[model samples]
Target chain A: MKPSEYDFVAARRRLEAKEKSAGEKLTSLEDAAARVTNGDVVAVGGILFSRTPMALVHAILRERRTGLTLVRNLMCQEGEFMMAVGAVERVVTAWFGIGLPWGVSKIMREHVEGGKVVYEEWSHLALGLRFRAAAMGVPFLPALTMLGSDLVAIGPMKTVIDPYTGTTLAAIPALYPDVAILHVHRADRFGNCQIDGYPHMDADIARAASTVLVTAEALIPDEEVRRHPDRTVIPGFLVDAVVPAPWGAFPHECYGLYEADFEHFDEYAAAIDARGTAGVTEFLDRHVYGPASWLESLELWGAERLARQARRAHELVPATDIMGGLSTPPKPPALGAPRQSRGAPRPPDAFTGYA
Target chain B: MTTIASPTEWLAVVASRQLRDHTTVFAGVGVPLLAAALAQATHAPNLTIVVEGGIVGPRIKPGRLPISTNEMRTAYRATMLTGITDTFLLAQRGALDVGFIGGAQIDPYGNVNTTVIGDYARPKVRLPGTGGANDIASLCRQVIIVTAHERRRFVPRVAFVTSPGWLDGAGGRERAGLRFGGVSGVVTTLGVFGFDPTTRRMRVDALHPGVTMDDVRANTGFEVLSADGIDTTAPPAADELELLRALDPERRFLG
Candidate 1:
């Protein structure tokens, strides 16, 4: 049902009250991990390896639960870790890979080939919109993609005749996960979160899930949270738990935090190369279980490696500044030498065609 | 080999030529990225490229071949950094002109298979399924495929079509209610191919320099028809090759 004016008013009052309430929403990573029972559908927030909630994901792995259904943009990198641990019995995603020589995921490929993992693959667009349908409280979303492609047959999608026009279009059913874990740069005591770079499918999945949990790089004050309310991708009202997890996305980048730890990826890749799925146990021991805490895991990298991973402000550019200052039009391309901006009025883009 | 260059280098050159100046191209990583960057640096400087991961009007980062479309480097100096939904919605509305696709296999009808090799449920090979390649092929006015020329890559029918290219041989996409344009052409290591207007089957428009019809026919698994006036693909000019090398000095894509 559509929310009424009273619902909005009530929600506002509760938020205002929470602002003054004793602020301590920080939960232990282990506690957060325990919430994820077996047979739960978990939607992870990230694209490739960027902004994945690694700390919590590791915690879940340590818990040793099975029968998980993972939903994500691409089942690769960190998602590959989940499959390696035998946590994910099924994956409902678009693409799966580590790129380069290894096109398909290693152990995940084995599990699927061995009839242990059920791979429910769809086009990336279909999966994104399916989450959107859940967010909007709709049964399905009509999409222009997958109608012509064979993904409609292999993946979980159906074609419906567009009621407005007599044309047939592909529709993906809603995918509301039991729990959605997002990694953010900062959050407050109230659980309001801020993502540094691209939200990707973070905000959508957070809303689409039955429960919203977040692992943040830092826990900021209420003023810092209110400083740019517009930047809040996950609102306090929707967020159920927040864990203060610095370097939460360790191997993967957290945008402004650092770059992807290719050293670790390379090491993992080398292990796979040496012994296909046989090397998984040693890999898990070294990476997932070896370290007691997420921070202690840094010992594997040592101090010098950490220094190189340090982030500079300028290098950590925002994908969207909730502060909303940047509206500058794209500058013309810089050719041969650095392009001298002669203030030439460029032509309209191809979207409108040449003017 | 085109004028005795590697297959990938030839494919990159031909793919870049397909892009028109003052148009938007929705492209992914590797050769597609190189093709767009090459076109920008040389003939089509005004070409706007939308990296499928949310970058619109992207200028290639000086020295990197982005592995994923959403790679942080892909967002560097981009015109607009929007989310996934907004970027693709533009294509759905028929805004983008060209969408570049790289596929595991290309069938006679220009249909692509990136899903699996053997079968759907139980497969010999599990190729990475469509990662917005379906949307690119379905919505763009024209889709350009860049891949190597191998008998295995060219099949009579794709094991599973991940993206449509005239679905069946002719009128299948139209019958399936595709709103916008279907596959226009394919640029491979050996030659350039386009769908025949009547049959909608892949037909050779041009061959790489020094490559013969026999060479092209031998590489393809299915029947390949030649157009009435086919041209030998022009060899990569020094300037174009230089730009491609500069963009990817590491030879990440070229190698």
Candidate 2:
């Protein structure tokens, strides 16, 4: 569909009607998953492996939600699993893969090739810009992405000539998903979410979607959230439900909480490689369907394994302290003769003491 | 010095040498990350490495190469932690000096195709579509492509242009309205390839140690061009190999 064809005004009206009162929005995983109807445009939060809302995805699968259009900037196992289980009808993403060590996802490749799923492509920046446009309540945003690429030729991207410069620019349409399911570091009962480390378009996705369902690792008090208001990436007004789901992004890394379960990924890769969709179904039966809750799902890996991931995560230096006391150095002058910089003096070397 | 470097190692070394000291590079996953890390460890300690996941100036740890750019390991010692949009905006605003990426296939004009192998509609391999590759290639000042050298990978024309290199050739990018930044070089397994300034077709700039022009010709699907004088790529220095091995002791990416 074209950007002009999407009803941004109606989406805004729907969001405006959602309860923005300072009341508890906390709910169970099943209850949150129920908000996502079949055939809805559900934007999955996080990029690649980090901070994926896998627990929410599993809950949706458990609820047997199908024919959903999954949208994200990047897709990994979450997209792969959903496709394997026949939940996704379409995926609007810039990239889809299992990443390195493990290469392209076998399930994604098969489904796209078989024409069972429609894989709409865009550049990573363009996808993010679409969310950005929606969040800003605009129909489209202009960008330099996908100018000469085939993505422009095939995808929904449109080009316009800039009257000011006469340069052709890509007009990225707003992507207003029906719902956005996100995994956060913490959130309060009222859905004041705080995402530590990289937010990775979650904030934009939350605002862009009409309904926002968050699965947080921890549920903090509203007092705690108010203590550091700046840390709140997604405000309570934008969120419809908050589900406390620890290890919600399991098998995937959650910043400051745990590392990705690489072994589990390897096992999943092997399973899909060996048996394709049937193998993924076996995995879902064991992990998604078999477990009673998100916590129980993590238990399938046993306490020792869970503890190891957490321990490894904690062992790494916190991002704030990684380069403590070391300031960024001034960029070295270019090899060629220096370009005129409006009469500004050359900065001193900040690396003098450190390096 | 007697150690024989693997193709990946050779590619990484050659790719790393393309990076200048103190330049900011937007590095993709796998070999691009490895090469960036290697460059930082050796000649470019001050190289500001930016991963697509919004990690800037990270001190990449040894033996713990990140599979995904968003992995916390890539966030280690990061100077700034932002989001995907903010990170790419840096490239868009011209803050990035280099964009290092890898692909499944590349055309004569250096246009990369990570999207598909055959027809986009059906019937062949559907590779992972463009991630931040197109944005990086289009926005960054210079882009370097690193991938396995094979005839299937180096095609005369890609099935789809996932990343715009030189588009059709010489003035293609300019005509396409991409004012700056086209592919600077492509570091492959057998040799280093560069674009002809006039035609913009990929040309053999240098063949790696022990690799012949015939090997490059046989491996590349396109009718390859040779520079006025093709140089032999220097073997990986002992220190370069040592540092690369230390970074990937498990040979996760090295292999």
TM-scores of all models? 0.88, 0.92
Q: What TM-scores does chain A show, candidate by candidate in order? A: 0.81, 0.88
Off by over 4 Å in 1: A1-24, A311-355, B1-5
Q: Model 1, B1-255: lDDT tens per residue? A: 124456777789889999989998999889998898888888897899998777887777666457778756776677787778668888988889999988788898888888887767778888777778888888888899888889999999889988999998677887777877788988988889998899998899998878888998899998898889888888887777777777877877888
Per-residue lDDT value at B43 in model 1: 85
Candidate 2 regions with alpha-carbon error over 4 angstroms: A2-5, A318-355
- For the second chain of model 1, what is the TM-score against the true structure's chain B? 0.96
Kindly give the stretch of ten consecutive residues in candidate 1 chain A with the minimal lDDT sum.
A329-338
Question: What is every candidate's C-alpha DockQ against the true complex, given to 2 decimals?
Answer: 0.49, 0.62
Steric overlap count per candidate? 0, 0
Best by TM-score: 2
